[model samples]
Target: MKVRTEMYNMFDGAKDYLPVGQTTLPKLYLILFLIYSGFLALWAYICNQQRKNVDKIHLVMGVLLLLLTLKIICALEDKRYIRNTGTPHGWDVAFYIFSFFKGVTLFTVIILIGTGWSFLKPYLQEREKVVLMFVIPLQVLENIASVIIGETGPATKGWFRWNEIFLIIDVICCCTVIFPIAWSIRSLAEASKTDGKVAKNVEKLTIFKQFYIVVIVYLYFTRVVVSIIGAKVNYRYEWVAVAAAEGANLVFYSFIFLNFQPVDKNPYLVLHELEEDSAASAHMWEENISLG
Candidate 1:
């Protein structure tokens, strides 16, 4: 029962109720908020430079970054409030509200990325839409369960129940996400056959495969590795687990944004204006030649 409880290590003979494995979270979240704020600014500049080329997906990523930054701010304040008062209250509610929305928005962005929606294509296939319909609802449920778990704390039976529900929904969403990435890769491979753009399609396929690998790594590290760390660390050093999970999250977000940035040459995205111009020019040349 001791190990099962969320233990708060003593500091100078006084119990700290800020939650074990998360005492450093306030500082961590502060740092994360600053980092994401900077990232959001840089992202805005990049999008501005390529305004004509950016799409809904590109803008969605910016929104995700903003949500993350704001959520980090709220979380830091809430944790500080808890550390001082021995309980979650006011700001805690705001934190969870932002957290829930951020999670759902993140899931939507990831789903869109895996399906190549708004980046590589303007439309979604029926199966891809179905994936969205199912996974988005599951993500919503997972977020709800996470909030309940957070409010109840890990020591309570209610927390245990909600945590289980959270895990089940999270696992389902993870499994569901993989399908779209795999489908995109398969579609690219098939397109390479008859599209007469073998080289380009192959490049796209390689990018998709790499994205898939990164997604798997991100999920594994954040979910499994972080849990393992929390369980294995000494009681006093529980903050390490929080740091590990947050660090992984920061890296994962940075990678996704950079990899799929709205640029003319980002192989992860579809070619638009420049390619269309080239094809149009080629067609005009052929027409002129035939007339002459």
Candidate 2:
């Protein structure tokens, strides 16, 4: 009887200490899924009309899907179903260290976005400039929140379900980049329409487009993996991995923009002028030779 009573007491204690399950997230997930599906349908329509215009939209949608998947899996893991014991023991300290670095990484990306946008303001429309600026601060705040929730682990086992908000922000911030990128694709398409040879070279000109999509997809999946582990093992630390991924993303975008050129009006004029000048100079040389 004594042994049975002790076991019951332990069970009761465990039950009492267990983290609270999310009461509202399921509804939010349903809503998010519905909204995302609607957007996907819209993207499909756009793609049918203009393939280039939809490329960035589709890419961003994929990233959002991956982030949402991560949030859902992590939430499920936190409930301790499926026997998932997240990270190994003695990992909490390491997790915190990573979180710090990741926070710094996120902050750095925000700065880059801000500074880059400021420099690009002359080229971008006012609305695009404003949206880019808005997303920078929001993304920074979301990263800060992630760090705070991560550090709260090993105690109550869960924060205020902040990951949900972070996921939403991720979707929005990624879309900020997506909208501009999509515009670029449309610009490319228009340029191609004007010149048959340039249109034929579309494949070459847009080579970097695929890389942008691939990097965003990679980051999305990594974030999901970290979220699942954080929630499953009661270990909420994703700073280092997240930071490294974001750093890679920063570099990738830098490369993309560096290689991006205005493909419409300037190149043709410059090439035409060079050809005419060369022809005139050659004619003058031929006349001098004939006279001699």
| CA RMSD (A), model 1 | 5.5
lDDT of 2: 0.44
Taking all chains together, the TM-score of candidate 1 against the true structure is 0.84
Backbone Cα, N, C clashes tallied per candidate? 1, 3
State the displacement of the C-alpha of residue 223, model 1, in Å, after optimal TM-score superposition: 1.3
Distance (Å) between predicted and true CA of 60, model 1?
0.7
Model 2 misplacement above 4 A:
1-122, 154-158, 195-205, 225-292
- RMSD (CA, Å), candidate 2 to true, equals 16.4
lDDT of candidate 2 over 130-181, digit per residue (tens)? 7656775776667666666654543544456676677787766665655554
Candidate 1 residues lying further than 4 Å off, grouped into runs, are 1-21, 153-158, 267-292
TM-score of each: 0.84, 0.40
